[model samples]
Target: MIERDEAAIYVDGLTKTFGSGKNAVTAVEDVSFAVAPGEVIGLLGPNGAGKTTLLKSILGLVLPDEGEVRIQGSDVYDRPQQAYEHVDAMLEGARNDYWRLTVQENLRYFAAIHGQNPAVVADRHKSLLERLDLDKKADTAVRDLSRGMKQKVSLASVLAGDVSVVFLDEPTLGLDVESSLKLQQELVRLTEERGLTLVLSSHNMDVIEEICDRVVIMSGGHIVANDTVEALIADFERQGYRITVRDIDDVVLADLRERFRMTSIEQTNRKTRFEIAADSATFYRLTDVMEHHEIDIDSIETVQPDLAEAFVELTKSSESSMKPNTIEKGDGD
Candidate 1:
């Protein structure tokens, strides 16, 4: 576990509820987590799962009914100015950039507001523009640029200042495939090269799986799972496997479906392919049943569970009991 003092961002027992009486709704409930310095943590949840509330609470946009939030050991509420001195955010895929100003000017303005001398960080700003493929648009007014270009400008603006911690909500919301990939790569590089602590929220699981050191999944106003991406996927019990076989009939298919959780059954040119989710014991039993049915197994391979699958399973499980379970990263490293 990371010590509270050492964490770049820390939240403890944070709870927030909207309204009052029976009409009231609890958005976040007793949520606690920490992000280590230079770590990229992904925050994921479905709509109305309290993700926005949690982020807003952490950013001090929304006051919580309970718990404390600290940034680099400075109490957020007690020392708001000090705690947020080296922090910035690109919320909802946009930053508050001056539309009338040129792209470079907006970056300079953001840097200046953050107590950074634009001239001093001019090289950094230039690199940001170049890396995001916005160098050509540097002199163009933000209002004249397209939506995708604006999104890139927003990200560059967030990194323009001398900040250590950044919170990005839907960073890739309006980006093209190439732009999104570029942004993801740059984010990873910036985190490694500059030790920038990032808390990214995106529905794109691929982005989360690719870059995040750990993921915090929220459901029903609670942290349902907090663990490294690999750990979360591995911890999921039902492993998926794709099997291709020949000499299989409807009776065999029906039996397989009855015995195990089956899906994606496809048949082509006398060959049958299907997928199943099962444990080791159940898998072996499935093989036995296939053998008894005289099925010729052409091939079989494990369908590795990715972050998206794990997210679904975790959120679904939390529906039954909204208990928080914090899974620490494994010691394998």
Candidate 2:
């Protein structure tokens, strides 16, 4: 593989399982991938698909049964503290804050630990609070803030350390539309302006599609697919085109039937409507047939599946293929 200067995280052959006997649940299996700097990679999967487990293992909160994980060229398991020196994470519940401390106090506390002096920390805190629109609430106790406000506080902790890479698990969970949009906008700004590499795990496909440059879909203890959102859409061409035509003669109708596999065909008094999944080549063939028959197209529309629908189809397909068949035990014979 060609080496890149911007790789922030590299994980290989990582595997983890819980339990010793028949109850053992394999969370991750031989997962390997790398994340580049300023790239927001979405770790997408349904619940119980090891996204959280994978994040915890990388953060050293849980030990992997096998495989290697590195952050910025340093092995997390071997270097431990040093590997995490330039890394920070914000998972569910935003547990990094002190409920008793005011927002400013919490920011100051984290900044001091990150080796910043009080004055410098305060300055940075002020700037971040202003940017995040939390300046007005800086003196409010963390315990009194709403879920969305605390999410901002959690993000503040990640920013306080000025880490190169940050991990956020379900960052927008339970947030209103306005708050979610703000968080996504801020994340994009951080990536574009500050070169922050982020690994975000969320069930929200829209969030992933909007904010992430690339996505890795995991299912049943494995990575089923990994690529850019555009590439994935183009690869499958899941969205079909719906075409309606003026009354077709016998020859034109026969031509269409022979040339393409029509997914749906409906005949009306004045027109014929059909939906089909065809690639560029197939579409060209379709056009040739239409031209030869001199058929008049009444209307045509391209339908694109939403990310949530795409994710469901992709992940569920993988899970179905991975399911093992049960074998019944024979009784006394």
Give the runs in model 2 whose Cα sits over 4 Å from its true position: 1-6, 241-301, 324-333
- Pairs clashing within candidate 2: none
User: lDDT of all the models against the reference?
Assistant: 0.87, 0.79
In order of appearance, the predictions have TM-scores of 0.86, 0.78
**For residues 1-333, could you state the per-residue lDDT of candidate 2 as single tens digits?**
213234688878888877757756677788888888678899987766777778888889989999888888778878878788878888874476898999988888887776777686677679888877789999999999998888888888778866788999888876888878888888888788889889988877778888899998887767888888887776676557889999798677876887786767899997999977777788777878888888899998996755665577678788787643111111000
Which prediction has the highest TM-score against the true structure?
1
Predicted structure with the largest lDDT when compared to the true one:
1
What lDDT score goes with residue 60 in model 2? Answer: 91
Clashing pairs in 1: none
User: CA shift at 290, candidate 1, in angstroms?
Assistant: 5.3
